[model samples]
Target: MTRLQRLVRIAWVFCKYRLDIFLPMAELPAPLKLFFLFAPWHLFPKGSLDRGDRLRLALEELGPVFVKFGQILSTRRDLLPDDMAESLRRLQDNVPPFASATARQIIEDSLGRPVTELFAEFSRDPLASASVAQVHAATMPNGRKVVVKVIRPGIDRVIRQDLALMFMMARLLERYWSEGRRLHPVEVVEDYQTTIYDELDLQREAANASQLRRNFNNSPLIYIPAIDWDHTTKRVLVMERISGIPIADIESLRAAGVDLKVLAEKGVEIFFTQVFRDSFFHADMHPGNIFVDASNPADPRYIAIDFGIVGTLAPDDLSYLARNLLAFFRRDYRQVAELHIQSGWVPPETRVNEFEAAIRTVCEPIFERPLKDISFGHFLLRLFQTARRFNMEVQPQLVLLQKTLLNVEGLGRQLYPELDLWSTAQPYLENWMRKRIGPSGLLRTLQTRLPSWLEQSPEMPQLVHDTLVQLRNAGAPDRGDRQAAITAELAQRHADRRWRLTLGALSLAALAWLGAEEKLVPLAQNMPHYGWALLALAGWLVLKPGRK
Candidate 1:
């Protein structure tokens, strides 16, 4: 459809759903408010559907891309009202599969082989279909079972067209809506564009699955199916077929005697492990992509699929995130606020005391509830809202992490309503922090860099001599007296370099020792600043004034 036609249809859907009633008419200009009065949809009687349902219906009617957008929005419980968020959560990506004949043709054309030649048996009917792709049951010649994932034909064209409409709408919202600039509608759309386009590449998805499998190799907590690389391609992926009950199938899981509480706790552990331990996590961890292996009912494991979208955090982000969560668990609002500023998540100029107070106000009441009664998703939402007052910019890289956390939390609660997320996660965070910042961690870092240090060791003496000479002669004039001054300056610089290096090494060693004792938690918390201090000191000593 043409962009103009699509826009008209969207407007019609809005009016038909009586969405105007949900808007704050008092806040809108009189002229625009009057436009709603004359809107043709007003001629029809108001339906029984609520605003949330209406919104979901409108998106579903728009197309697969719109439906997918709603699915994403559903995860942002912090941004939307409870009713709307709940309603959108039900937006499923159950689009009808494309023609089987067309699918077969594409497979043949892409692989340059007939379906029968590639597989011992290929199912014509799709086992499942989503907006971007569909999975079909197939078997290899060796009698091993697998699934063929095919990207929807011409999906890129459709996505680009819808994305153009989305961008146009986002621009309109930014221009006309008061909250648009704060929300950053354009950036959000661009992020979604990048994510959805990434999902179009099956090869990327295969790599994600392989890496995850390796991360959890032989582990009992989670199982990632093996990718059949020989048969995989950019447009198609073949992976070991895994059979298990859907994670949402509570009845089936219970029937199999799976421990719901343990299962729920494991979900949280898996998420933390993926985010903090491996730094690579499945971003699209909705129930549809998750399954429960009940072979051992006492210790159920997660079987994950559809790794098209994944997330990774930088080292600083990972460290700060772990510390923040640990602080939150301890109800250390002050530490949490400090971490935010230290990590540059909020502006450096933000007042730690005031931010801490605000966080306390928002979090204290939530703590009154029992662990099982609290929702991490809502807590994060409240935290985000509070951070906004300090002009905290959204971290786009962390969006997927946030979304995956919501999914994990939701799925955990669904499995066992009484799950103590805090208790389950606190120890994990504490352990991760210790391993990351403790003496052992320092030793590990040193071990990893030892080779490089040794490789450059031979040049160190020359480097030191050259640095001293440069510092001594930096502003010395070419004269007889200057020659003696330069020599004296060189000797002084050499002495200063030794002392500076000694002090720096001692400071780091002391820090590591204190970290081992857990006495340097506060120091570790402020490690970023200490790092900069060390760097500045090293630079100053290397260029400090000498006898000259």
Candidate 2:
């Protein structure tokens, strides 16, 4: 459908669902307020269903893109209240499945073979379905169990249509909204576009799965299914079929004698390990993408699937984030505020004392509640609300991490009510911080960076010579300096030799310090003094009168 028609359809859905009440009339522009007053949607009665249900139904009526958007927003528990998030979470795996025959046709065409020839047995019915794809059970030619996933026919066109509308809306919001610059609506849409397009390509999903499997190949914390590359393609995927109890099925897990507490803690550990140690993590960890392998009821391991989205952190973001969380865990609001300004995520001119007070106002009251009663979701909700006062913009790169973390927190709370989230995560953050600062971290840093420093060292003398030449040329008189230049040239020749020697000494000092910092120099002493002496000598050579 064209974007205009899609927009009309969206407006219809919004009207039918009576979504106008969700709008903030007080904050809206006069034009918008007037438009809403005359909007045809006002003809309908106010919805009896609550706000959350109204939103959920509106998204469901809109189509797959809206459904998937709701699914993502559902995981962001921190952004929504409990009832709203719960209502939207139903969109996670409830996307209607496409016809089995159509899926079969896609598989056949993608693999260039008949289903019977490729699999020992293939099931027509889908075992699971999602916005972009659906999966069916099969037995491979090697007699191994597998799942066949086929992309929804023509989903790309549908996504692109919706994405175009999203971009339009985002641009309008960025242009017209009061807080547009701070919120960065267009950039958020851009990141969402990149993420959704990546999901459209099954090969990228396969690679993501393989890398995650390698990240936790043998560890018992989680199990990732193996892919069958021989049968995988851009439109189809065949992978090892795994079976486990649905993570949300608490009663079944209890019946199976699983230790819920241990299971919950392991989930937390697995998430931290992926983020800090592996630096790679499954971004979509809602219960729909996670299952509990409770074969060992005493120590249940998680079975993860659906690697369409993943996240990684830059080394600096990772460090600053971990420190920020650690500070929060310790109730050190000042440290949290300092880390924000220090990381350049928050504005430099922001007063740290004021920011700290704002954070404390938001967080200190939560301490009154028992550990089990405190919600990470609520904490984040308030913290972000406070962040707006300081003009802190959204970090697009952390969007997936934030969503995945909310999912993890929700799952942990579901699995075990008394789970102490702060205690569970604090050590991981502390350990991660230590690893980036301690002796081993320093050694690792040198090993990775020393070569580049050495490679650039030889260019220093030439750089100095060029700078001196530029200074001499810039300092030259327009016409009269030439008479004195002949005499100065003779002196300059002598000065140049000393200047070159000093430059050489300075270069040596750089190399020596690099080695000394890495501790290659045994009992290294006065390395800074040596650098100062070299710098001092270079200054004297440059500043001394040139025999004129």
Candidate 3:
């Protein structure tokens, strides 16, 4: 459809579902308000469904791209309201399969061989169909079972069209919505655009599978299918096919005698291993992409598929995240709050006591229940919410990680209701910490870098001599220059202190203004003015330089 026609269709869907509740009427532009007003859907009365349901249904009715969008949004409980997030979680990417003829034609074109030559037998029927791709079961001439994944025909054009509209909507929301700037609608859409486009490339997916398979070469916790590179192409992926019960099929898993408790714990182990151990994880671990290998029912392993999306963290980010998780497990609220500032996740000037209290209030209640009863996903949501209150900036890299954690935790709890994820994860993270930050870790680092240090050792003496000569020319280390350097360092420290005080003053001024404007009503009502004044006074004690 033309872009104009697409806009009209979207408008119809919006009005049909009464999704106008999402828009802040006063914030909308005049022309846009007029356009929606002229739309034809107002004649019919609105349905009895709640606002969240209306939003979910409208996205579902919009087609594959929007269904996937809703699913992505559902993962972001931190960004959306509770009702909306819950409703969006119900969005499913259950698109119908495209024509087998088209799939066959695309395969032949990508591999430069007919389906017959590529595989001894190829099923015309699709094994599964998702928004971006469909899989067909096949067998090679050597009788190796494999599955061929083909990108939907002409999907790129459709995605491009939809993405253009998506960008426009994101811009509007970010411009007009009160929470738009905080929610970062445009960035979210950009992330989705990158992800959906990445999924369109079969070769990338094949590489991801290969890397993950190599990461867990022979481990039994989780299984990633091996890629058949010989027949793989940009638009076509061929991988070893294995039969297993879907992870969501709990009844089938139970009937097959798979040990549910062991299976669930193994799933958690695999998740932590992928994240902390390997620093590479399958971001999309939804039930549809996961399965249980019931061949050994006593020790069931997870079979992972659809490696189109994955997450990796920077070394620093990974370290901080590990520390934060460990602190949370220990119920060290002060340390958790401190870590947020130290990691730059929260503003440096934030009050540790207040932040710690906020965390404790949100999290302490969470630990009151049994491990199986606690929702780690919801815990993360609350943590993110509290961080938002402190003006903590969102880490885009961790978004996928948070989503995968939710999936893994949800699946874990589903498989075994009494699963203590904390028990399973706490020790794993602690062990990782020992290996990562302990004396052994230091020795391991030295061992790995010793050879490189030795390789450059031949120049060390000359380098040292040259440094001494330069220092000698500039006067000895014990001379006036050294005292001058110390004096300069002292001056710099004083300057730094001065700047910090200046920043604190500005922050206090801002806080005073906010208080005077009656924005502190709830806070003042909760605490006397003197204590509230003290709290506002400490606002300037923020560690980081004041933000403009």
Candidate achieving the largest TM-score? 2
Q: What RMSD, rounded to one decimal, does every model reach? A: 7.3, 6.8, 16.0
Candidate 2 per-residue lDDT, tens place, 289-321, comes to 899998999989999999999999999888888
Q: Rate the local accuracy (lDDT) of all candidates.
A: 0.84, 0.81, 0.84
- lDDT per residue for candidate 3 within 1-548, as digits (tens), equals 88889888998898889777777777788988897786576765688999889999999899899999888888887688889998998887888999999999999999898888878999989999989999999999999999999999888988998999999989989898877887788999999999999999999999999999999999888888889899999999999998899999999999999999999999899999999988999999999989988999999999999999999999899999989998998899888999999999888899999999999999988888887678888889988988899887767889999999999999988999898888899899989989897645654565465445434533444454455546555766555566655554555455545544654554455456557656557655775675555444444344645222
The TM-score, computed over Cα atoms with residue i paired to residue i, of candidate 2 is 0.84
What residue runs in model 2 are displaced by over 4 Å at the alpha carbon?
A: 21-36, 74-87, 90-93, 460-548
Residue 21 of model 2: what lDDT?
Answer: 71
Q: What is candidate 1's lDDT per residue for 1-548, written digit by digit as tens?
A: 67678778877887778777755556668897898678787776779998799899988888889898888777665456779988998887889999988888888888889999999999989999999999999999999999999989988888888899889878877776776776777988898898898899999999999999999999989999999998888898999999999999999999999999999999999999999899999999999899999999999999999999999999989988888998898899999999999988888999999999999999999999998899998899889989988888767877889899999999999999998888888888888888888777876685466445434543555676666666656755653466756566566556656655654574467556777778777755775774656446554544555433
Worst 10 residues of 1 by lDDT: 450-459
TM-score of every candidate relative to the true structure: 0.83, 0.84, 0.82
RMSD of model 2 against the true structure: 6.8
Q: Alpha-carbon error at 258 in model 2, in Å?
A: 1.3
Candidate 3 colliding pairs, count = 2
Off by over 4 Å in 3: 29-41, 447-548
Better of 1 and 2 by lDDT: 1
lDDT of 2: 0.81
